[model samples]
Target chain A: MSRDALQESLSAVMDNEADELELRRVLNAFDDAETRDTWSRYQVARAVMHKDLLIPRLDIAAAVSAALADEAVPAKAARGPWRSLGRLAVAASVTVAVLAGVRLYNQDEIAGAELAQQTQQPVMAGPQVKGPAVLAGYKESADTTGPMANGVLQGQSGWQDQRLPGYLRQHAQESALKGTESALPYARAASLENR
Target chain B: MRAIPLLTLLLSGWFALPAHADEAQDWLTRLGRAEQQQSFQGTFVYERNGSFSTHDIWHRVQDGQVRERLLQLDGSAQEVVRLDGRTQCVSGTLVAGLGNSRDAPSRALDPQKLNQFYELAVIGKSRVAGRNAVIVSITPRDQYRYGFELHLDRETALPLKSLLLNDQGQLLERFQFTRLNTSVVPDDRELQPSNDCTPIAVANSKAPEVQSTETWHMEWLPPGFQLTNTSARKDTQTKATVDSLMYEDGLARFSVFLEPISDASVTETRTQLGPTVAVSRRLNTVDGEMMVTVVGEIPIGTAERIALSVRGEKKPAAQP
Candidate 1:
């Protein structure tokens, strides 16, 4: 693109008047020093026009770019049938790491469950493990092993167990009472009280 | 030679974008007016993280007045009745010292205002509640809020199904109608609360003395959010005053509650129940330590940010 055209696109982007193509063009040209300088100049001009205070020398985009440039890139693996196997191994390890992280995070919940088991007190049952029945069949229920399952906070004995439920109920009820959309908020509140 | 087709492709996309947006905007406008003008009753199921429940609704609009009654079909027979957007009664355990922001009028769904924060587009057509429907996708412009996919009935413009999705495009909650009958206006008998539905007390006598002494403000907030209501109510059990602020960006809402905490053992907690997330943080103020809990149908990260940003405006006398 011509210098004038690039400058025009930059100004258009600055004013939030750019179409997709103009935005693309401006972003593509952003690596050029002159483009960056023009963009900063436009920012200064706009700020002056709006009577807004601005540190003219401060350029967050340039600083971010510099920091990003300094960051290390992951080395690419050699291409082979082994690459796919290697990727699978990496994925498996990542999954294991994530599961381990979750288990560690839910220590309190596990402890609570153990306490419940020892006490022989019936813990609130988790959401029924059911197959996807709705449209798109995106699983409707989230992971059930977390701190709260089926709207009942589990394994939590102190402040959260007592205050969190009331706070959640209050928030939902207040939203239901104050909301304009009506049904959704009511459903949310009723869902909370279901337990 | 390839330039012509590319130009045509770009031109088509450029032309098609606004048309889809306009169609979606029209559908939203119809939805905003649907509740006020149309009367419908239906059975809908609400599902969140760990909870799922089905409910029946009876909505009637007569002489510019709207009356709605909802009853949980299963589990505890929780019920609520509203007249002209105001809560008239609620069954089941009511939270003690519920704030009296009854004077704050309910806000209407404003598509124009929503457009500022969410990109609205008519995604496709669908069949819902045995009725033809148009699907509208409302994608948030920022990461701070969740997105929604709404299926509105073609004839009535009422929502037949709604899905809330997070940034990863995971469904957080689903509200879909299984049956709807708009042709029949619900009678007064259908709108009446059952014996278990207790009437909501107005609490008019204590209204004047419930003024909040401390002014709390946020250091940062997600763009487009505006404070809709602020209330101070004494906790019935603890007797500590709880200051609450509710914020909304036309479509989504979240509430922040600040209460003085004397217990040093209490730690910050974060948890999510379905679409709603609760994040509590301890804030040290001039008075003492206050627990700031952010509860909302927003992402946990946003809730945590809000919890951390809460600041009591009261300063020590020495700090000018």
Candidate 2:
């Protein structure tokens, strides 16, 4: 009869609807072999109801207890000249990292500034000729025009290529025709035509 | 002790910046008035990546009436003539359904309203088309729109040059006059459209009458954008029904196009040309799969987000 009461407490605890007394009863009976087996069977049955794969032997609680017992407290080391050397190494690495980060940030800013200046120049340069020295020389001869990285839209050249240009022209033309900013939209439409 | 003087100096500098901002706002106000008042004829070059073209514009204001004519100087003479913001005639290609009568009154540029979305400031001065110009930078407050650096004529406040810039300050497109003459008003002969220019029939256009209501709606849009227009039409090529919705955020505009997919093989795509970004995404609705294409002069990320935010409007329960 007591075993039956303990099993009832186990069921309540598993459902997370247990009172403090029932929870304590299940925890106390957890050391008993038959109760543990009953708990495992209940878990498997719940897993099956939930359509989750039931691992036959997953005693996480016992494994955690064993691990906790085997774990050792870390030993504290004495501070010495070697510790100071380690501190120095850390400081040097941090300084290097900060300096590198600053350098990278500065380079990005400078490159951006240079690009802005190039874009503003009155003379018309070939689209391929703009940008860095590397990209300027890299002819876009690839047949596959995948999504673009820098411009309005870049993607694979299949359905998009077939329909996108028409959609763009229509949108640009309609916007130019509809919106009050007459010249801007017209310019946008005309630009699309140029492409 | 040192902090007191530093704080005072910083406070004064902060106070002085607003004065310059007021000056920029004043210039913008002048620009609005300039378009209605000034008479000018000029040839300007519009340039973007992979495209460059020159165009001539003749804007004349007489007897409180504004008339303008624009013609491509280089290419096959693409031309348009407008009388007071209404297109009278267009050459080369005629866009159906967009007649003069359908045009809602153009919104006047409000510096106050624009200030909410863009930080306007007079950066400096420059000379364009042999005229003294004040450079006004309209930097967008959000990523949804691009920034504009406008070179307004110092005397007339007319935009002599305009540059569209991306978030990185890289120029996407440039519109600047190489030659401008404001002394002489363009005569009626110059303002008149050529014989070949086709007149748009505003009376019997059936396209504007049909509107798509509640077919699709955006789940989320960038703050400040509003639906301006919506239309449903049959796709000429695919023969599929296409629904289009247009939205505007005072300065920027974008169009969302939804077309039912008969072929299930089409994949999502994105494309960019100059300042314009087009993002296409496949959306599964209660009916079937639809391809949503968003095209506009918006950032690619903004376009993509907008494309993803499009959702079909929910149907109400059928009454018994």
Candidate 3:
């Protein structure tokens, strides 16, 4: 492409008004030193016009290009039987990972249930029949089997397990009652109450 | 070479941004007024990380009043009834000592106010609930809030589907209508709450004396968030007075709860349940140690920050 046309395309790209063809043209000519210089000069002019603080000497595109050139390409000679062997190894590892993950998940659920049982012993024996509070905490433990799933606070069982559920329910119920878009908040509150 | 033409193009592109934004704003305005003006009933499914529940909703608008009834189809029978934005009843479990303190007037969906915190744009069109829908994306301007993708019905402007996304563009929660009937206005029988649905008690005539005295303030709040409600209630179990404050930035909301914890066992904790996150921090106050817990549909980091910023306002000396 002509330098003038390329410059026009570059300006259009800078303005984010370039069509796909113009963008392609500018990108294709971007590797040329003259084109790069013109682009930076245009950027400087635009920065001056817009009063934007810019590092005029910083050319990220040139830096990136140099990095790309310096990057070592991996050997592509290995083929056939070795590639299949590698794929088999990957498949075997994936299966092992899946099995381990499932086992870990089961263990987490068991641990969560045990912790929940321990917490419930006091509440169950207490005279104050705060049914919702107990149920809310129980439901949370049951729902969140994985420690990090849904960002559940797992392993920390002292005050949060006893109080967090109540706080969450209160917040949801309050939001539901006061909210204008009733369905969303109501759904949220109802979801909390689900056992 | 083509400097003048390029400048004109750039200027035109800059001017075009607001025009697109205006269209999104118009759609949002229509969505805001859709519920009050248009009566519709539908079945929607609410899904979060580990929970999924289907619900049937009956909404009727008659004589400028909006009545809505929602019932869960599976699991426990969770029900709620509302009249003209005020909650009338709730089924199943009702938290003790809740709804006693009257909150500030419920604010309608204000597009103008929302535009400050969120960048509203019409992304594209889609089909939802077997109806044509326009997708309006509400992107948070900062990291403090999550973004929302609302699929509004093209015909009635009612929201057919809504998706809450975190900063990583991960789906936190989803509310989508599986079936909607805009033409059929739900009758009185459909809007009636079930016997299981217990009516919420009206606000007490006599305000609690402690409401005036107990004061708590935040050192810093995320931009665009405003204090929407403040209430003090005595915990039925712990017997401790809990001061609660609710803040919202038009679209997103969060609540801050401060309760004096004399027990030293409570440690700082943070957790996320789908779209909602709860963060607890121990705050040392003049009187005692207070546990400040922030619970809302906000980012965990933001909730943590808010929890840290809770400060017990110093009480003035006795005048007498």
Candidate 4:
């Protein structure tokens, strides 16, 4: 339940128009958007009828949301069922973002950066290198006979000499030719051909 | 004796429980030890972008020293020999300019610092290099790093295959062996580099010089990243010097290359390959029109911001 639904249910109770079942339903979904909107509407209507500007606008839900956003609003939430409500809200938002495309971009660095060595590049040095630049050196080496250009393997590690780069190149090329969905892989393959 | 099979089955199940979800750390630990301890030789394939290659690696550790050699089976005799963990000789066109190999020291694998940016766990199990293997995962803790999953030979702790993944779980690259042999140690002749192998003069070496302060500096950086390496090299074609700097956050790394352009017509360009995104932005440095090209495995938006953030420190402050 969200904060809005609860406030709406409270408004219903004040009007004495809601029965036990309706009250329960309102309480259950009090934090919901629809319920909050209805609650705020009822409050404004009641205030207008009573000719009481004691609480102008009576847009309780918006104020509550702003309070939550600012976090400067008092946490006068009742310690009862609302505790579970907060947990449910957080989990809901996370699930939505995870299920949706709202990924948090905190950790997504370029792939294979771990291969780059980290140096203390103080200001005494020119500019600093950030992240894992593991294979940047090889990018510049993509030439006519470069291992990548030839689409063949190179190295002295007995097995890697025969294999590692082949695997890397195959993944790139296969991804380029096989996928019909997007052009990203094709672009990558083309980049490899850039020499 | 009759109950032994049942007992063994129960014991194995218990052992497997701890490895399932915590694969990232286990995979990294396996990779850290794989090349050092595993004695194996096999053919494997590596692929990225428009290229694919087949090669063989023979790694053996004895008397506390690692001896390894690699050979490209399909192409010319591209070979290398490493006594401990350093490159001895290389037989390839890339290293043709042996007169000036970068003076940076050889980098070592450090599992301790890697964990700061990556979440290590065990994701699943898979077979690789024709051997039973365990899968270990390295997931980035934030958007500043890519992820890797490694399959290690169960018996020897050697990496049989490795996969790089982006934030969306898309595969970027793969390195895996098709066959492997653990019984025999590779001979010295197999570890030898080809005729093209030329020994680098280790005694006479110099780091690339850093150019003037008016070169470049970025005003914006993701939370904890800082500059790490910088060098200036004279461009052969234009005869103008280009300044480059690299930055890293323990795990993630990127490089910013600054080259001055003679004309004002340079355009901003962006490209993406797997998890790597490169963005080049034009900036007016006091010296002239400078092109700041940021190349790394990062989001396109972040790359753009970094490109825009570059400023030359020595450029005189603009008058109001």
Candidate with best DockQ: 1
lDDT of 3 at A53: 42
lDDT of every predicted structure (CA atoms) = 0.78, 0.71, 0.76, 0.54
Per-residue lDDT over B102-218 for candidate 4, one digit per residue giving the tens place of the 0 to 100 score: 444423345666765665556456677668987666766566567677677888767677666665554556566889898988777776667776444431133233344464667
Residue runs of model 4 more than 4 Å from their true location after superposition: A1-195, B1-23, B75-77, B95-107, B202-216, B223-226, B249-252, B315-320
Candidates arranged by DockQ, highest first: 1, 3, 2, 4
Query: Cα lDDT of model 4 overall?
Result: 0.54
Q: Please provide, for model 2 over A1-195, each residue's C-alpha lDDT reduced to its tens digit, 9 standing for 90 to 100.
A: 397888888889889999999988888777677888899899878766755533334454454344333332111132677666655555554454455435434434443443454355443235435666434322331211235433234436666756777678768777766754547777777666543
Question: Which regions of candidate 2 are displaced past 4 Å?
Answer: A1-158, B1-18, B202-214, B314-320
* Residue range B177-234, candidate 3, lDDT tens digits: 9999988999999998888887787333222424524478888999999998887776
Q: On residues B50-129, what C-alpha lDDT tens digit does candidate 1 reach at each position?
A: 66789999999999999999999999988999988888888886766564664587888999999888878887788988
Candidate order (lDDT): 1, 3, 2, 4
Lowest lDDT sum, 10 consecutive residues, model 3 chain B, at B203-212
Candidate with better lDDT, 1 vs 4? 1
Residue B21 CA displacement from its true place in model 3, Å = 0.9
Docking class of 3: incorrect
Candidate 3, chain B, TM-score (2 decimals): 0.91
TM-score of chain B of each: 0.91, 0.89, 0.91, 0.77
Better of 3 and 4 by DockQ: 3
Find the 10 residues in a row with the least total lDDT in model 1 chain B. Answer: B1-10
Backbone clashes, each candidate: 2, 9, 0, 84
lDDT of 4 at A59: 35
